[model samples]
Structure formats: structure tokens, C-alpha cells
Target: MKFQLDEPQGGNTIHRHDTRSVWVNGTEHRNSLLVPWQGTVEDWRLTRFEDLTEAHFERIRALKPELVIFGSGSRIRFARPQLYRALIEARIGMETMDIGAACRTYNVLASEGRAVLAALLIED
Candidate 1:
């Protein structure tokens, strides 16, 4: 799906998002990735939802985002709290949603200048 931004400044804009890809700043990304409010996008070398571990959340925590919008691929599935114990310990909140919702939410929060990260999974 494509998104039109009302306020396009202050952070990265998610122009389009789908099951296998997302367009960030007009460039298409076809992999799981970490989208920060105003920083370089990082590729997340992950394939399966079941493979998520505390280490993944810890990586996000290291970036120091106040919150995370975790996209569980094509569906909305919650990871066990144990899998993200690092975020909890760091006081960094995470919200789980389907990939599409996560993309939209990330754009909104990012435009508002909130410290947010979208850990979107583009799984096969």
C-alpha cells in the first residue's frame, strides 16, 4: 500500500509498505529492517517469527528508541514477553501489530518527532 504524508519532514517517511517490501524515502527495501525515526535504516537478518530472541530486542534497545513498533510479518502475533525481556528491562515499550499497521504507525510517530523504531519483519 502507498501512503501520502501530510507532514513529511522531521524524520523518515514510509511511502509504501506491503508483505515483502517497504519504500523508505523513495527507495524500496525488500527485507526485514530496523527503521529509526531519523537515522540509517538497518537490515535485520531474521527470517522466522519463532526465531525471535532476547538478542533481537536487545539490539533495538541499544539504539535507545523510547518505543518500538514491532511488525510481526503478515499477521499480528505477539512475542512472548520473555523474548523481549531486554526491552522491558530498558523501559523501552514495544507494540506488536501486523506489518501494515506497524508501517503506518511508525510513519505517524516519526513525523511527530517521537523517538520510535519500527522493527518490521518482511518474511518469506
Candidate 2:
């Protein structure tokens, strides 16, 4: 779906998203991604939920966003806390949702200038 905001966004904006792909800054990203508040979008590498590991969470933790929106693919799935122990220890908050919902939430928070990151998983 397409998204719109009244005012201009100073950071990266999620323009559209579906089950397979997400459009950010007019670029199509079919792979999982790390969409930060502002900066070049980074590829998250994992394709399926099972491919996720603690290293993935650590990658997001290293970014230091105040909150993380984890798009756990087409469905909502929670990662075991141990997988994200680094984030918890750092006091970074995270929320999990389906890819579509996560995309929408990320855009809203990003538009509002929140220090957020969208860790989207694209399933094959």
C-alpha cells in the first residue's frame, strides 16, 4: 500500500509495501532491510524467519535507535528474548508485527521524527 504524510519528512520514508517488497525513497527493496531514521538503508540479509539469529538483532542494536519495529515477515512472530539480549541490555525498545503493519508504523514514527528503525524480513 502507498503512504502519505502532510509535512515533509527529514529522514527516510517508507513509500509503499506489500508481502514481497517495500518501496523506500522510491527504491524497491525485495530483501530484508534496516531502515533507519536517516541514512542509507542497509540490507538485513535474512530471507525467512528461521534464518534470523542473534547477530541480526545485534546489528540493529548497534544502530542505537530508540525503538525498533521488527517486521517478522508476512506474519507476526516474536524472537526469543535471548536472541535480542544485546538490545535489552542496552535498553532499546522493540515491537514485532507483520511486515505490512510494521511498515506503516515505521513511516508514522519516522515522519514524526522519532529515532526509529524498521527491521523488515522479506520471506520467499
Candidate 3:
């Protein structure tokens, strides 16, 4: 799949410190976009949502994020009920949206200072 990183507003860096708006594949996204962050995809944990396991859930849990966004690729199906239950048991807010929307939501929430993570299952 073709992947492009749309810069946040002002074309600032989309780093840990810099906060800005962005568009992932024509979809508008703020820092508040929902996402299932797997500890910097560039450096570690590069895997699809379907490949995640309870151990992965434990890692995300350690982040203590307020919400966990699960990007089920471009479609909102194939949610791992087992993982969902684990998250629910931890009392973490969870949202399952399309990858595009997930990117947008992750940015929006992150900008708002809400703890959020995104798992973008970009299946090309």
C-alpha cells in the first residue's frame, strides 16, 4: 500500500513534542484522532492488529492511556473480541474506527492531552 505522512498544520514535525493537524489519505485528522499506538511503528512493534495478542494488550495497558483506538484497516470489521475484553477489563476507553478515521481521531485526542494509542493496520 502507498503510505504518505501528511504534515500537521504549519507543516510542523509530527514528533512527540510537536502537535499539529494532518490528513492521512485525504482524511482530515487532528491530534485528537483515535489510534492504537504500538510504541513508534518506525522503531518497534510493527504488526497488524490481527496479529496482536494479549501480550500486546499488556504493553498498551502499561501506557495507561485514556483511550485505545483500533484501526481495522479501511473497514470496521474483524475486531478481536478477546482483546476488546481485555481492554474493557482494564477500564480503558476504546474506539474501533477505520484506519483513516483512526489517524484523524488519534491526532485530535493526542492534541487534547488525552492519552491515546492507535494501531493502523494499513493492509496494502
Per-prediction TM-score to the true structure, in the order listed: 0.91, 0.92, 0.59
lDDT by residue for model 1 over 11-123, one digit each (tens)? 78888998889998889999889999987898988888988888888889999999999999999999999989989998999999999999999988988789999999999
Q: Which portions of model 1 show Cα errors greater than 4 Å? A: 1-10
Cα lDDT of model 2 by residue, 1-124, tens digit: 7586553456898889999999999999989999999888999999888877999999999899999999998889999999999999999999999999998999888888899999999888
Give the clash total for candidate 3: 24
Write the candidate numbers in order of decreasing TM-score.
2, 1, 3
Q: lDDT per residue, candidate 3, 26-87, as tens digits?
A: 44443333233323322114345556567666666766777877666656865676866667
List the candidate 2 regions with Cα displacement exceeding 4 Å: 1-8
User: What clash count goes with each model?
Assistant: 0, 0, 24
* Worst window of 10 by summed lDDT in candidate 2: 1-10
Instruction: Pick the winner on TM-score between candidates 1 and 3.
Output: 1
Winning candidate number (TM-score): 2
Q: Quick one: how many clashes does candidate 1 have?
A: 0
Per-candidate Cα lDDT values, in order, are 0.90, 0.91, 0.54
After aligning candidate 1 to the native by TM-score, how far in Å is the CA of 78 from where it should be?
0.6
Measured by TM-score, how close is model 3 to the native structure? 0.59
